[model samples]
Target: MDDSSPPEPTGDGHYERLSLPGSEFSPLDALVALVRERGLFVLVAGGVVLLGTAYALAAPSRYTATSTVVREAQSEPEGIPSTLPSIPGLNIDPGNAGRTGLAPSAYPNLLTSREVRLAVARDTFYFPETGRRTTFVKHVNQSPGAVELLIDYTVRLPWTLMEGLGRLFRDADRRLGASGARSPLLAPSEEEQRALDALEKKVSASTQGTGALGGESGLMVVSTTAADPTLAARLNASFIEHLRRRVREIRTQNTMEHLKFVRQRLAEAGRELERAEDSLAQFLERNRSVIAGGGAPTLSFRRDRLQRQVRFKEQLYGQLQKKLTQTRLRLQRQQPVITVAEQPTPPPEPSAPNRSLIIVLSVLLGGAAGAAAVYFRSVLASAEAQESGREKLEEIRGSLTAEEIVQGVREELGRT
Candidate 1:
């Protein structure tokens, strides 16, 4: 074979190899590769491990309370259930939503709605970091839970740097806001808005369906997170109460509206009937002789007309009264669709800030750093060795004969 060509493997698994490139680096090889930077690598990797440990220690624990609910059909509701249009992301399956109509799917979203959340805030008390308990609607901010605390730790320095830069841009607009120039864009007042935002984040409503929104069954979950376990449980319970009340409102709103309109019509019909009867009575009193005279032309025509109007009004009144009764029955027969499947209980343990996993990941991170360092050094060494070998080959070629080069190759192959 030519000197530049690769040799084929011999039958005994030996070959006259001409070149070797360091294609693979095993774990042990990685360790031995970066001998010169071992101290630096140790320091950096150890620092990463220490940082992770500190983060695990510093992160606060948070409790989660959960309430379960199920979607159910009303007992033989007449007409269509009011499909109060759901918020965009609330019901995942828009196409399948109309199968039973909007009412069933809307129950889940009713829990997370702005109205329900606002009402919950008004009911609850807010305890700030350094103050006494005040009405949540006045000024409310609950510190973020464990997950947020962990994220804070992870991105603390970088976030601080970014925050400073952001301030440079937003400082003027903030001053304008502080001065009472109401920003046209924001709907809620600052205090109310903050409370809503906090409550929104703390509350989570999830359903058991594989639909676009996921969680489809009658099964649903309502959860709340707070620093105090009891508070979390209480919030969840309160939210559920609001949800039930809202469900009742939605269920009866249509019927009640129809009932109100029917009652108005019934009253109007009664008044018209009374007026018609009174007019007929007065006309008879003025012309009592005409009916007794039985063929007074003017009296007969006037009396017949008045009698017919009175009869029509009476019939209309009866119809409206019947409609009123039916509407009331429709409202009364419909019971609460959403029932409490499971009540919220105080969670005994914090669900977040997985200390064990955090530590394990920290160690793995350190190991990864060490591996990277080793690979970096190995590449540099390989480049330097290649350059040195190239220089040596040039020197050898200039000084040695072809026979020497061939003999040296044979010897090297034999030794291998």
Candidate 2:
């Protein structure tokens, strides 16, 4: 027997004797032995593979629908607002006001907003096999109420208890640490709160990925997966319509406010002009009796001064009036910043369940799981072998060690 070989169990089991072969077992040889001798292991692995294949076949198909939205950066006409004060004069080229363009970053929040979600939920329809028209929310709610009830009960009771248990487990850190004292968990910070809020919005929006469909053209892509393709198309179209309506309403409100301001200024200027004319008339009427000796020069100078004043006031009033008109026109037109670049069409093919991809993924996952099961079984078998050997050693040696014998005697005496 070679000294380097593992021991073989003796029949009495008091001590084992080792027997070594002339050549040592290589890694490749041991692996081959494990595979050949462990027929159960291979059978278990084959069973796992078969089970995984069954699961993949039994799994329901899932579909993904995608939509795209493009950002339209509408440039406000230049010089309209800048020439506001000089509307009556052509000398000054009034430039356009610096209007703030909507940022793309804002679109994620906008698309995921509660208002948009609710609008989609309300407008989207689902056609059942029965050919009945059902809104999206209604369809979701139509599922067996028992499932919802069970979920509610679980959330209301065990969920809260589990959270408390989690806190207790986490508190174990204090016992292991030097401080021994535990700090209370604090509420989330403002930034954390904002992040949570954004997360909630994103979840509600259900937007799948970073891909957006539309570019600069006010076109939006709205897509939804439903049992009926026609219903899905209609839902997308309705969502777009609602979005447009909301945008129009916002634009109209802004335009109206601007128009109101312009009209107010126009009214004030008109009142001031009237007051100036009334004052000039009153002054001339009172001074009608007082004629100068050099009537031509005095009258010409007075007339020139009054005419210049009136002309200046008239120009100011005219500019204000023009601004008021333009504002009103803009309010009426209410041009939308976003235009529909592409209208949704009924999709001929379902966007979801890419069968080829699903099958490929299923096979890969099944293979990986099968491999893992094989490895875990090998480890468990090794552990069992070590445990069995230790038990056999204990059983063969009935005599206790000094400390164990003393403790056993003491325990027996105490019981007596």
lDDT per residue (tens digit) for residues 301-378 in model 2? 775676676676778788767766665655555455544445555667755456556566655665555545545544
The count of residue-pair clashes in candidate 2 stands at: 6
Q: Which pairs clash (backbone N, Cα, C closer than 3 Å) in model 1? A: 92-213, 207-215, 208-215, 208-216, 209-214, 209-215, 209-216
Q: Name the weakest run of 10 consecutive residues (lDDT summed) in model 2.
A: 199-208
Q: How far is candidate 1 from the true structure (C-alpha RMSD, Å)?
A: 14.3
Give the best candidate by TM-score: 1
C-alpha TM-score for every candidate: 0.61, 0.59
Report the CA-based lDDT of candidate 2 relative to the real structure: 0.52
Please report, in order, the local distance difference test score of every candidate based on alpha carbons: 0.69, 0.52
For model 1, how does the per-residue alpha-carbon lDDT over 122-214 read when each residue is reduced to its tens digit?
A: 775544343556666664545566866667666686875675576554555655657565543344454565667678888888777655435
> Model 2 RMSD to the real structure?
11.8
